[model samples]
Each structure stands twice: as structure tokens, then as C-alpha cells.
Target: MAGGMFIFSAVDTQAKFLTDTLHPFQIVWFRQLGLVLGLVFMLSYHGASILRTAAPGLQVLRGAVAAGSATLFIFAVSYVPLADAVAVTFVAPFMVTLMGALILREPVGMRRWTAVIIGFLATLIIIRPGTGAIHPAAFLVILAAALFAVRQIVSRALAGSDNTMTTVAYTALVSVALLSVPLPFVWQWPTEGWQIALLISMALMAALAETLVIKALELAQAVVVAPLHYTILIWSTFYGWLIFGDLPDLWTWVGAAIITATGIYTLNRERLAARKPPQT
Candidate 1:
């Protein structure tokens, strides 16, 4: 979980820096490029065959969903407060609870169900429907989470069919290919040494963050890792404060706390379930 946040934080910092000029789609293209490079390097080191699976459609869907989520997240960051954006993305985990039950046929008890409800509520608090006009960017994030949740669910289903490396490789390849269409309109020369450096760094960090996140998932239960989604906001708050002198309003933190608490409780319950003795 900590590693996942670490990866996402690096990616967020990179995205925040580019939000001023680079269209989110272009930045995501760079990220996809970097991920492809990283995937190539990692596979070379691991000596894994790239096309180890046949789920091309599923792989492409995962990439499209992830790319779209990232584009929306960058949009949200540009308009909404950082913590609020982070809090909104936390909805992915809670949304997953529903997906797991419905699509994967996983059992979710009342306690877990209630936690999912609270997690969804945290998002409502952040958006606060009809409480003055809400930021349109928030809805982008909601859509992102919904798509991302589906992607994660797809990953869960694909796990039995493919190795993680193939999954990452194919997703990056598909995303980079898909994003290639919009490169011409928003393309701008990187005019400064620091700007070039920053883009490169962001790409690297984005890859690092994802690798770490995947590692976190391997080592920890998704339920436990789910709550750690809020920590990205903590990091975002700090980054926004340092970079833009921006502080999240009270409602952001309040909502984030509720989301985090519920996420942790759901994971803890899952952890306990995993610990129980097998039936005779």
C-alpha cells in the first residue's frame, strides 16, 4: 500500500508540473511512452516472453480505461483541489467492492458492504451535489474511477490467464498506440532543459509508481491497500501547498478521512478472513 502511494505521488507530482501547458492527453502519451520503454527494459531483465497471453481485447480495455482515468485525473487536478481529487479517486476501491460481487461473484458481507457505502459517501461529500455549483472536473474523476475499477476487475480476471509482465506490457503498448492519434494538435517542442528533464522524470516516476503499486498489491490485501488511496491526498496536499500555496478546504480532509477509515476497515476484515483456519 505504501509503495502504491509512493508511485502515485511521483506520478501526481509530475502531472502537476505539466498541467500548466501540456494537454493532459499529451502528458499521458509521454507516460505511455515511458511505460512502454520501462516495460521493454523490465522484460529484458526478467527474460519473459511478451505475448504470453491471448486476451488482447481485455488488455486493450485495461489500457484504455487506465489512460482515460489518468487523463481525467490530470483534468481534475487542474481545476479541483488536490485533496478533493485524491479523495474522489478513492472511489475506485469502493466501486471495486460492487464489481467484485457482481462480476467476479465474490462474497461481500454486510460489514464490507457498509464500508463501501461510506466510501461512496465520502465522494458525495466532496462533490456535495446541489450545494452550490459543483466542479465539473469532479465528474471526470468519478468516471475515471468507474473505468479504473473495471480495469482492475479485468486484471483480477486476467491474472489466471496471463503473467503480470505480459499484462503490463500489452496494456502499455495498446495505450501508447491508442494515444498516438492526438499527438499532432497538442504537440509542443520542449523548449527548456529543465522542461525536458521534468517530462523525463515524470515519465520515469509514473512507471516507478505503477511498479511499486503492483508490488504493493502482491504483498498486501486489496482491502488493506484500498484505504491507502487517501494517502495520495496527504501527499497531494503537501505538494499543492509547496508548489501552489494551495490548501484543501475542510470538507476535503473530512471526506478523505471517512473514505480512508472505511477502506481500512474493509481490508482488515478481509485480512481476518484470510487468517481463519480452513474447514475440516
Candidate 2:
């Protein structure tokens, strides 16, 4: 998960850099192209069977949600600071917990519920609606986070029916296809060699990050690895400072700390619940 987060941060860094010259939609489409190419290479040995899934509808839905999430996030990052954008997206875990309770009918204790509330409040601290600290674009990150939570929910539903590679492949294919629909209107081909290289790197990093995440989840318990996602804030802050000369303010860090702590707590609670034996 840590490796995956770092790679994703790199992808975000590239996307932010490309935003200077390309539209978010174009950047997103290019990122998906890398994912598709990477998946093709990674699964080449497995042959076409690797793409087969019993839940094609659900897979397509998940891919569409992922496309929406990616587009919104890229758009948000184009305007918002990387650290701020990342911090706000951390709210997805809390949203996932809520959705699990309401949609999955999973048991969520009061303690976890408290953590959820605290997590959201922490997000507000970062956004601070009435204050000037918040960017109007930050809300796009929040919306993206919500869609990401939906993706997680759908993923949980698909877990029993499909392998990891199948999920990843379908997502790449679907997202690329969906995002391509707007290419004619917003597409801008790179004029410089460095721009082309950056776009390719962005795609490769995005694909690599997704694969690493899938492997991490396969190797470790979700609760154990999920907390590592907070590491993205550190990487994002570093990249933002080093590459863009943007540092998150004191309040951003404070809110991010609160959100991270509560998110970890929430995941820990869920892990503990899973360990408990079923009630009669």
C-alpha cells in the first residue's frame, strides 16, 4: 500500500504538471491509456481469459465510477494544492463506512460512527467553507471521494466473483473508453518531446500504482494496509513543495492528521468486528 501510494503520488505530480498544458479530461484519458497498456503487458501471459468476468455489468459500473472519480480528482488537482486535494479525498474511507452500514447492512458500532463524524468534521476544518482557506475546486475532491467510496462498495460486491487482474483490466478498458468520448472536443496532442514523455510516464505510474494496490490488498489484510494510504499526504506535500513550490498550511496538516487518525480508527474497528464470531 505504501508503494502504491507513492506511485500514485507520482502520477498525481505528473498530472498536475501536465495540467499546465493539457485539459484534465485529456490528462485522465492519457492516464487510462497507460493503465490499459500496462495491463495488457502484465496479463499477456495469462491470455484473453484474464479479462473474463461473470459480473460484466458491475465491472462496467465500477469502471464508470472510477472514470468519474479520476476525472474529478484531476480537475480538482488542476486548481487545488496537491496536499489539500489529497487530504480531502481521505474522507472516502469514512464515506465507505457509512455506505457499508446503510447499503450493505453491515454492522457499524457507535464507536466507528463517532470516528466517522470526527473524520468529516476534520475535513471541514481543512475546507473551512466560510473561510478563505478553502478553494472552490476542493468540493470536486469531495465529490470524487464519494464516487470512490461507491467504487469500493461495488468492489466488495465483485470480490467473490472476479480475480484482481480481471477487475483491473476491466477498469482500464472501461475508463479509457468512457473518457475517450470527449477526446474530440478537448484533445490536445503534445507538441514537445518532454510533454510526450511526461504523459507516458503519467500513464505508467497510474497503472503501476493500481497494480501495486491490488497486490498489497491480496497480500495483507485491508485494515493493515489501508492506513498506509495516509502516506500519500506526505508524498503529495513533498512533491507539491519540490515540484510546484506549494506547501499545505498549518490548518491543512492539522485537519489531515485528524482525518487520518479517525480513518485508521474506523478501519481498526471494522477489522475487530470482522474478527468477532457471528451472533445467533
- Per-residue lDDT, model 1, residue 109, is 93
lDDT (Cα, tens digit) per residue for candidate 1, span 184-238:
8888877888778878888877777766665555555565566666667778778
Off by over 4 Å in 2: none
Whole-model lDDT, model 2: 0.90
Model 2 weakest lDDT span, ten residues long: 214-223
lDDT for each of the candidates?
Answer: 0.77, 0.90
lDDT of 2 at 81: 92
Strongest candidate by lDDT: 2
TM-score (C-alpha, index-matched) for candidate 2: 0.96
Which sections of candidate 1 miss by over 4 Å? 43-48, 132-134, 273-280
Error of 2 at 214 (Å): 1.8
